[model samples]
Target chain A: MNRTQLFEQIKKKSSYLCVGLDTDVDKIPTHLRSAADPVFEFNKQIIDATIDLCVAYKPNIAFYEALGPKGWESLQKTLEYIPKDVFTIADAKRGDIGNTSALYAKAFFEHMSFDSITVAPYMGEDSVKPFLKFKNKWVILLAHTSNPGADDFQLLQSTGSGKKLYEEVILKSQQWATPDKLMYVVGATQAEKIGGIRVLAPDHFFLVPGIGAQGGDLAQVSKFGMNKQCGLLVNSARNIIYASSDKDFATAAKSEATKVRNEMENLLNSLL
Target chain B: MNRTQLFEQIKKKSSYLCVGLDTDVDKIPTHLRSAADPVFEFNKQIIDATIDLCVAYKPNIAFYEALGPKGWESLQKTLEYIPKDVFTIADAKRGDIGNTSALYAKAFFEHMSFDSITVAPYMGEDSVKPFLKFKNKWVILLAHTSNPGADDFQLLQSTGSGKKLYEEVILKSQQWATPDKLMYVVGATQAEKIGGIRVLAPDHFFLVPGIGAQGGDLAQVSKFGMNKQCGLLVNSARNIIYASSDKDFATAAKSEATKVRNEMENLLNSLL
Candidate 1:
């Protein structure tokens, strides 16, 4: 989806929420195991329950990949099942050299038809530029990740630019892509830094993870991270999807999503 | 395979050559397209031809992932077909948060059973630590890549440590893994910088890509990068695998691999 289309969805939904489909087979309701494809069945219900409440659905590729070929099938089904108006993200942290990265872009953007795929910026420009070649497809590069390991190399100060590695990633990447095709994955755990990041790329969107179960405060992220366009897709996975283990799991998930959406509604109203 | 086993294999073969099975369906000989599971058939022939000449096989995951579920099936079959003595590498540059990374490790290490998997170090310690938890498996981190874009963030000098961004990746990553389990990708194109990288990571093995097709000089990489253990696996992909487009494609691939192996043999003898 293009920036305008995504912004339209957010405005219509009143929530820039992206429900992460990090669906683990072991964690799904026990009764679904008998189904031919439990993972897809679980995701179908989740999408049905929460599609109206959120503007995007992010299926973390690792969760599906762990299950092997069948997992990929589940992921494809989930992608096909989601409403076209809502955006889809292949939360696969993929990046390589130019030619190899082109195949990845083809894999996620062409074959699977995800509107965006999260890419690791470690390999630098050529690794990321392939994804930007596709119109309306987004490249959400990893910035200050929420994980404990974000401190490893991303926070280091570059002597040449005198900018933190993540800052440099944002700054340098702008040369390759505009706000229309690029976004940053800024962890909600680093909410305080969101204001600073906003100053760096004020127009670009941020795919904010680490909320809910990861303990990131939504209010803080919404306040500091949102731009004039409400440039944030706050992802909440486990807390919303696995809210109940009973037959009413989908309903329970909808209730959790509704609560989050209600809060996002208030936040959007405050912006207006 | 463990470090000792890998070194022993290098000693036995008298070569540190890694055949990258970047088997693209479109690139394979026209005759094979008629066969069922053509990508696997192409890889099987390539592996069968080069198995004696090379000690390792590195399958760039993008080639397989691009074909969807069938591509993954081909990868699994190819992994199963490789000799147990030969080290297998999933050239899947994947990394995420702690819990998510564990799943990727499980997908490649447990389900696919590769000897090693290349990981991107942008997220830091926790993103890489899960792969280390698996016994006898290796984590080859991207240091200085071969692509032109490597100059973007990797070569930038870090103010805090007075090290280049790639150097800081090597230095900081040492705290999370030992030389026995951790290796770094020092591209053959960066042969001039190999000496300084060897000083920082003297014992860790280097998975060197960018040979013939990418204009990386094998002799330069060998002279500057080799250590006491002959710690390098120089990879040659397109130049070797797509050496010919006829029915003699397998033989052509074998001939190309043999030439690279012969050069490596001389280099190893010189070191001894």
Candidate 2:
């Protein structure tokens, strides 16, 4: 989906929330274990419970991949189950050489039909450019991640540019793709930095994780990260999906999602 | 495989050759498309032909992932088919937040049983540390890549330490894992730089790709990059695997692998 279409979805739903499907099989409800594809079954219910309350669904690809080829099948099924109007993200942080990256773009964008795939920027331009080649697809490059290790190299000062490595990434990547096709994964845990990051790429969308289970303050992220088009996809995974480990897990998820959405609606109505 | 076992295999094979199974289904011989699992069939023949000549088999994950669930099956079958003596590399180049990285490590190391998996160091210590938790597994972090875009961020000088970005990666990563568990992906294309990178992590093995088809110099790499234990796995993918497009593809692949192995053996004999 293009930036306008995504923003439209957000406005229509009165939310910019992106529910993450970090669905680990071992953590799923015990009753669903007997299902043919428990992961997909779990995701189906989560999507059903929360689809009206969110604009996108981001599936952490690692959870599915850990199950082996069967995991990939579950992921494919989950992708097919999500409705077309809501955006889908293959939260597979993939990047490689140009040719190899092209095949990845083909896998996520063409074959499985995800609207976007999170890419690692360490391999630099050619590694990321292939994903930008697909029309209407987005490339959410990692910048200022919420993980503790984000400080390791991302915040290092570049002698040449005098910018932090993540800052350099944000500035340099603008030459590759515009806001229409490119976005940044600015972790919501770094709530204060979101404003600074916003100033760097004023028009670009930001796929913000680290809010729910990571204990990031949503108000801070919403205040600093939102833009004219509601340029934020604040993702909440564990706190919603695993709200309950019983038969009422989906209902619990919906309640948690509804609470987050109600607050997001107030913010969108007032802020955007 | 442990470091000693890997070196033993290198000594036994008299070559540090890593056959890259960057197997594009479209490029495989047309006759094999008729097989029940054509990609797996193609890989089986290639593995049968080159297993003796090469010490490690690095299957580029994108090739399999692009084909969807079936592609994953092909990869699993290929992994099971490779003998225990040969070191297997996922070449997935995956890294994420701590928990996520753990899942990826579980996927590749536990489920797939690869000896090593290439990881992107963009996220720093925690992102990579989880992979090190696995026994006898390796994390071959990207230090300097072969693609043209490698110049974009890797070579940038960091002001704080006065080291290039990749240099800092090599230096700082040592604090997280011993050389036995950690390796670097120092592209053979930049043969001269390999010497400098090797100095930073003297004991760590380097998985060198970009030879053959990518025009990396084998002689320069072997001369500058080799350690006492022949600490380099020089990969050649398209140059060897797609050597022939006819029914004699396996024979052609064997011939090419034999030529590269011969070169590597000479390097080991004279240099070591």
lDDT of each: 0.93, 0.93
Q: Kindly list the per-residue Cα lDDT of model 1 for residues A1-272, writing each as its tens digit.
A: 78989989999989989999999998889999999999999999999999899999999999999988999999999999988899999999998999999999999999999999999998889999999999789999998899988987888998877899999999999999999999999999968899999999999999999999989999999999988899999999999999998899999999999999999999999765
Q: Where does candidate 1 stray beyond 4 Å?
A: none
- Tens-place lDDT per residue, model 2, B1-272, is 89999999898889899999989989989999999999989999999999889999999999999999989999999999999899999989898999999999999998988999999999989999999998989999999999999989998898888999999999999999998999999988879998998889888899999998889999999899999888899999998899999999999999999999998888899754
RMSD of 1: 0.9
Measured against the true two-chain complex, the DockQ scores of the candidates, in the order shown, are: 0.90, 0.90
> Could you tell me the lDDT of residue B63 within candidate 2?
95
Worst 10 residues of 1 chain A by lDDT: A152-161
Distance from true position, residue A209, model 2, in Å?
Answer: 0.7
All candidates: TM-score: 0.99, 0.99
